[model samples]
Structures are given as C-alpha cells and as structure tokens.
Target: MLRVLSLLLVVQLCVAQQLEWPKQYTAKGQIILPYGDIVEPFTAYVDMSGKGRSRIDYYGGSAIVLNLGDEGQYGAMFKIVYETTQDFANVMTCFAVPGASGAPVTPQGVLPDISMYKYAADYMYNDVMSEIYISNNAEEEKNNNYTLLVRKDNKNPILFRFVGLDRLFGSHYDEYVIEYSDFETTVDATVFDYAKKFTCKGFPGPGLTLAMTENPMFEFVGAGEYEEKHRSYKVDSDFEEFKGHHSRQYDDEGEEAKRKTHFRHNHRYIHSMNRRDLPYKLRVNHLTDLADGEISRMRGYRHTPDSPRDTLYKPSISDVPEYYNWRLRGAVTPVKDQGICGSCWSFGTVGTLEGSQFIKNGMKNLKAFSEQSLMDCSWGYGNNGCDGGESERAYSWIMENGCIPTEESYGGGRYLMQDGFCNVNKSECGAKISMYMNTLPGNVTSLVMAIAERGPISVAIDASHKSFSFYSHGVYYEPACGNGADDLDHQVLAVGYGTLTPGDPDSEYWYIKNSWSTHWGNDGYVLMSRKNNNCGVATDASFAILN
Candidate 1:
C-alpha cells in the first residue's frame, strides 16, 4: 500500500512541472523537418478560446488559417489553406470529410474539439527540468541550450521548445522541433472573425470535394456558419465595389449577373488572400475576368533542350550580395505589354540581349532591340514566332544572323498577336552577343552570379497558375512550381535579387522583369522567392555574353 501511494505522488509531481501557457499566444521560428531539412521559417498564431483559431505564415511559402467550431455550433468549422511561396499564394478550400484522402488537402476540416489546446495537454509536460530565472533576450536560449524555460512571471514557460517527430520520418527515426516564443494571453478578436462569418455566396457550399482545386475563384475560402442572410449583403456590396474599382458596365441584366458571379468569386478570393496578411496581394486585374484558357494561352514558352555545353557551367559563386537590382543600374528596359500574344520568349530573349548591350557599352543606350525580329525571322530556326518558341532557338537565330536589329530598324512590329515576314537586313546590327552561357538546372547561385556580374538572364518558370496571373505585388512563390522543362511554360528575365527580412534566408527573392505591361505586377516586375529557385528561375536560364 505504501509503495503504490509513493508512486502516485511521484507521478503527480512529474505532472506538476508542466508549463501552463495562455489561451492565446504566438510563436515564430524555423520548422526543422524530420529528414534533416529546414523548411521556410514560420510565424504561428494560436488561440484556444471558444473555438480554437490558428494562423501560420511560412515566410514566402504557403499559409494556413483555420477555425475549430465549438459544440454549440454543431461542430461547424472552416479552414483556408494556400500552397504559396514568397511570390504568390495559390489556395484550395476543399473540405472533404477527414478520412477521405491521405493528402494534406484531405485533413479533417471540421473536428469535434479544438486541437490547438493539445499543445499544453497533460502528456506534453514530461521532463520539464528545473526552474531557472532568465531575461527575455538572446542569451537565454544559448545559456539554457533549449532544455527548459521560465517567463517573466516565473510561472509559465516563455521559451517553450517542443522537440517531436514529424512521423513523417517513419523508420528513419528523425525529429523536428518548434521553439515557441512571443507568448500572450489575449487573441486579437478580429483575426478570424471575417472568415468565420464568410458566406461563400455565388459559390457551392463547403463540402468534401474529392479532388484538387476545381476552381480558382475559391482560392481564399473559409467555411463559416452556414447562413442565408449574408448572401444579399456580402454579394451586393462586393459587386458594387468591383464595378467601381474596374469601372465596368454590362450590356444587359443577364450579362451583369454573369459578370457578378465572376466578380463574387474573385471578390471572395481577394478578401480571403488579404486577410492572410501575407506579403503579396491578389487584385481583380485584367486577367481576373479572362477565361482559364485565355490565361494559359498568354503564357507562351516552347521548351528547348539544353545542349551539352549548356550543362558545363557549374555554379561556383562564393559570395552573393544581400540585395541586387539591375533596374537600379539602368540595365533594364521599360515594361512592355505582350498583349494577347504568346511572345514571352521573344521578350525575355530581347531583354537579356538589351541588358548585355547596355553592359558592354558601359550603360549607353545603343538602341531598343526588336523582339519582333526574333518573332518573325527565327521561325526557320524552330521558333514558332508569336505562337510559342524557345529562347535557345532565338539565340541561335541571332548567332546565325550575326546581329539583331533595333525595333525601328526592323520596321517596328506587326502587333503582338501575330508574326510577320522575316525582314532581317542580314547586315542589321544593334545589340550583339559573342555567345551565351547557361545555368544548370535549379542552380540559383549561378543565376545570381550571371545577373550580378554579367547581365540579366533569360529564365523560364511555371507561371500557369491563376494566382500568378492575378499577382499585384509582393514576392511570388508557390510550392507547386516545378523545374522540369515541360513544367516551365512562361519566359521572363531574372534581373536582380533581394531579401525582405534580414537574417532570414527564406526571405530572399529574385527580381524578375516580365513583359506583361506596367499595369501588371509591381509595374511589370515580380520578386520571385530566391535561394530555392522556387519557380524554376534557374532552370534553363541563359545569359548573353557580349564582347
């Protein structure tokens, strides 16, 4: 009997050492994956009140904001998950029943209880170590070696570090850690309020749709308490705002209704995206109303295989700048619109040639090189003109012809939508390149070197997603971006690189100039997530070697 009593007492004492956290608190740190890889750093906001609410912004990566419903609400819950990078955020709001799919998208959207409360549950208090006094400074984490933590009140833990398995590691037996900080007691009520009350009007009700995102309009969605009253107010007000912003007028009432449906979709998506408070914003721009096929046709890039010599240049960059922009040096030309043409390759090709010429002449504007020259004349070299083409073929055509002509020298252009007869004078010469160099697949270091030390590099990226089309500002990044030749469908120039936050490697970005006009992006440029080549910025990138 005495032995049993002693064991019970010891267990109770062990449990007593647990750290009691506030109902609402926030933490920021890195997510070291179980496979010994560190993902983009993240800022997590967790609230365990009435219904648990949490928000996580993973640097320039994806973000998650969800609300766990209470019993009184009949287990109603809502979640919005975005597959994003620093450049752009692509969202999927499918709420299939929990066990329907094993993928991240299939996770139970509605749960019986607030799972966030489990962070401080009974089982998490084991081996809390001794109580120690420490100030809220950098020295504390190093002095204690992340063994234990005690906050200002000396009651609960301020520097709480949870080292656990990503299980995710499976047989490898690896572990990941979340060192939590910035503890608080009160959660901002306004955080998830808008989403919790969202009606998702003009769209289907939130349900388990057994597929990837079926529509782009539902990008920023969080299923709220199903209500009918919100329909009239939310949809009507948003429609008016959309009309005023874009100054739109319909031919008839039916057409207005149809446009309203698209407006509602984009309005809801834009609202949800802004609510995330991520660096980037999605605007109801010109591409917003365009059909999906139209948007796809706009991204014209025909993939060409890199020759053996292209693979020879391995990245050997030792030191790179924290920030660099070719635009600041006047190496970049003013943004031009591609219109409805699939001439992105020609634009990127011309951009690099123009930059090389500027650099070779010591920042002297020789002449504006003609993309139409490449579009019309490079057809025999396997370029499809405005229909679609590869930068490699265009470069080859330039090399074969020995030089490229200025826009005026080539008799201007035959508009962006079509190609004209090859009018190369054969003797025409403006911008010239001795040869071009290529960067290895996904080798971002070489990309930086080529851009900083040489000139702008023509790069291909997977920008087919609607999120990229509607991007207004902020670093564009999405995890779904692939680096394969087939995956890359849009051509752009990597003109510079920079960091949004110092000391954070994930905050780095690549400044890419696009040919989508000054009205698109931040005056026709996008800051792509750097370091990781998030959108295949380095894959098949070519630099003009001007003599």
Candidate 2:
C-alpha cells in the first residue's frame, strides 16, 4: 500500500510539467498516421473573444476554422485549402448560410467532439507524461479508443493517439498520433470571423448530403464529381450516371449469375470506395485517354531490351530497414492537384526531379519543378500534353533543354487545361536534369534500391478500373487488375516503400504519390502491394538524375 501511494506521487510529479495556455493561444504540432506513414504538421489558434473561435492550418496548404458560439451551437466549421496559383484559399464550411432555412445544416458530426476533453482530469495516468486512455464511445464519434498526452497547466491535450486493426484489409494494426506544440494564448481576432470572400464549396466525403454542410475532417469530395464540376456540391448528377451504368451491367447479366460474377471480380476491389464514384462515361474516357498502354508508343531507348536492368550493386551483410518513407526525410514535395488534365506523366516526371534535387542540393534548396512547362515544351518528345505523355521522352527532353522552370514562373504556375506552345525559357529555369532511365520491368529489388538510393521513381499502373478512382487507403491489390506492361494506364510516382508489419512478407507495399489532389486517396497517395508486381507498379519504373 505504501509503494502504490509512492508510485502515484511519482506519476503526478512526472505530469506536473504544465502547458502555457493563455486565454487566447496558438499551438503547433504534427499529426502522424502510422498505417499510411503520413506526417502532417499543423498550427492551431484559439481566440477567446466574443463567440470563441479556433483555426488550424495544415502544412499541405489547407486549413480548418471553427466558431464555438454557444453551448452545442457551432457557428461555422470551415476548411480552407490554399490555392498557390490563385493566391487565395478555397473555403468549404459546415455552417449553413443565413436565410438557408429549408436547408437547416446542423453539424453532421464531421469534427471531433472536444466536449469530452474537459474530462481528461477524471482519467488516471497511463504514463509519466500524464498520458491517459479515454473511450470515444460517444454516439457521434467514430467507435475507437483514444490515448491522450496532457499537460498540467491546461485542460487541452498535447497529443491524441488512436490505434486499431484494419478489418477491411488484412488484420494489420494501425496507429494515428497527433501531437500539438507551440501552445500560446495570443490569437488574432480576425481568425474567429469566417472569410466570406474565399471560394465557398461543399464539404468532401461520402454519406454527407450536399444540402447540409459536412465535417471537413472526415468528409471528402469524390474524384468523379470534382472532375465534372471542379468542386464539391450537394448535388451528385455524376453519381446518378454511375448508378445507371451499374444497373445496365446488372441487367446485361442474368440475375442468378450476376451476383457470383460480381463477387468474384470485385472482391479484390471491395476495399475501394472509388468504384461508387466512377461513372461509366468517365471510366471509358480514363481508359481511352489517360491510360499509358503504349509500350510500343514509347520513344527512343538506350538499350533495346525490355527486360530488367543489370544490378550494379548488391546487398551486403547489413539488413535492409523494414520501413522507409521519403516524405519523413523531406525528400518529397507536397501533394498537387492534376485538375481536369490527365497530366499524371508530367507530375510523376517532376516529382522524380524534385526528389532527386533534394538528394543533391539538400531539401531546403529544392523547389517544385514545372509540369506545365513539361506539357507546353515537350511536344515532339512524344507527349500530347494533358492528353498523355511518355515519362522517358519527358526525361530525354529535360536532359537536352538543360533546365526547367519552377511552377511559379512557368506560365504563371496555373495548370491550363489545354496544351500550349513550347515555353522553354532558360532565364526562368529553376532545375536541370542530367540523365534518366526506364527501370527493368518485373524487378522489385532493383526498383526498391533505386528509390532508396536516388529518390521517387516515375511508374505506370492499370488505373482503368473503377477501384483505382476512389481509393481511400490500404495496400491496393486487385487480382482483376492486369499485370502486363501494356496494361499500365496511369502514371504515378513511387515515393517510398514499407511493410504493414516489419519483416512480414504479406505486409510489403509501395508508397505512391498521385496527382489527383489530397481529396483523392490517403491525402493524394496510395499504397500498392509490393513484390507481387501488383497493378504493374514494378513494370515500368523510371528515375531522373538531377543537377
């Protein structure tokens, strides 16, 4: 009994380190997703003025602003995404506009409930940091357990940790850790008031109605809807079209056999939410235009062989690390939206250059290379701009041109929908490529080594399937997804590689960076199964040598 009392005293002392929480304060911290292996740093501000408001800014050029007016009354929960080219932010709010009576938008529970946060003191410490476990069994909150790291001086927690096993994918444990920092009380009054001038749009994510404002944290706009309308809305005419297509397919197959065929071909894609979003018309368009099915369509090559490249270096006695992510190393760039254009090739090409530049000149000096420049300039080199292009040809042109301009300088940095004339102005150039090569097909080890040594590898995949469009998370592996080099339709960048469980063969996967924007997949990226040549990721990998 005496030892237990002494241990409690020691634990209390450990948690005595107080947080400096002023009446109005600001805190900065990084939110980490262990399963996705994504780390996003954010800064949040609180204003205790008239109604009480807070704003949180993500490092990925996005933000969330909330108005805590009265008890249970949320004035506005707004998400503002910064548009670098437009020089302004795009706003999506959860509060209804004044006079929107028929469309009474109550909080559909998008944001996490902080009402329980005050209960932190009631919990016992699990660690010396004053870490305590709390139940998120609240009616609105997603069913999960939370471990919070708290400070003595303030009621606010410094970190919120969530851990669970993936039920949809193979049974793999996932962890999400959000750590706060730079806690201060000072805040700007203007932050509390919503910015009405910004581009206001619908909240993103499934199940939320367009008529009602959605919780931006959990809600996301579908890619198909974005492609058709360029923004999120309550109305989903595109979704209706997809339903019609599915109905037609259902009718085409006899009812008895329909269920069995659907079950067999779609079980692999069952994990994807994208299939629900992809319409038949859009799928056809993606297949015809964006798919990179032309190995024969590719231009000049150093060696005629289409097989694997000869290994120059071999692994020694040292064991390869189980996990590696280029983003954590500051080698990769922030996610960028490809917009309506099928410019995945250009984005992938530029991503390789950006990663290589970080390796050579250090991350601080690295800048976003121009995909617009690649689209406008690399004409005769085999790319048809937004229509589609060859990664090898883009690399070859960069080598000859000597330098490529930064996205900001090249034609004002905005992604124009159509192809423009070659605008290779050396005076405005920001980066130069020395050389590049196509990785040997079917060589996972060599591809892994190349990404580890150099940086992101540009590659192609079979994105014609509906599952590819609405990918939310998890290692994507569809048996229906073709494995041939010609089956590769969409171009993406392989940024890193890791395993769900260290040294577990089934857990191996590659981290791919997509150009479809942050709302698309797990914040503009996807995990493809490693080693099995899943979805043709290892089929056609390419890397750039940067200056």
Across 1-547, the per-residue lDDT of candidate 1 in tens digits comes to 0001011111211223334546676555543332222333555555656555555444432444333343233332244444344554454432212211221221111111111122211222334432432111122112211223344333444232322222222221112234343445555656545444443322243333311122111121122322122323555654676677667788886566556545544544454454344557776665554456667886889875543233345455667676788889898888888878899999898888888888888887745788888888888788887788878888788878888887766755344457877778842577666677787678877777777777788899999766687788877777778877788999999889888877778768989999888767888888888756777888889866665
Off by over 4 Å in 2: 1-319
Q: In order, what lDDT does every prediction score?
A: 0.59, 0.55
- Deviating ranges (above 4 Å) for candidate 1: 1-263, 277-279, 305-311, 314-318, 426-428
**Candidate 1 TM-score over all chains jointly:** 0.57
Measured on C-alpha atoms, candidate 1 has an lDDT of 0.59
TM-score of each: 0.57, 0.46
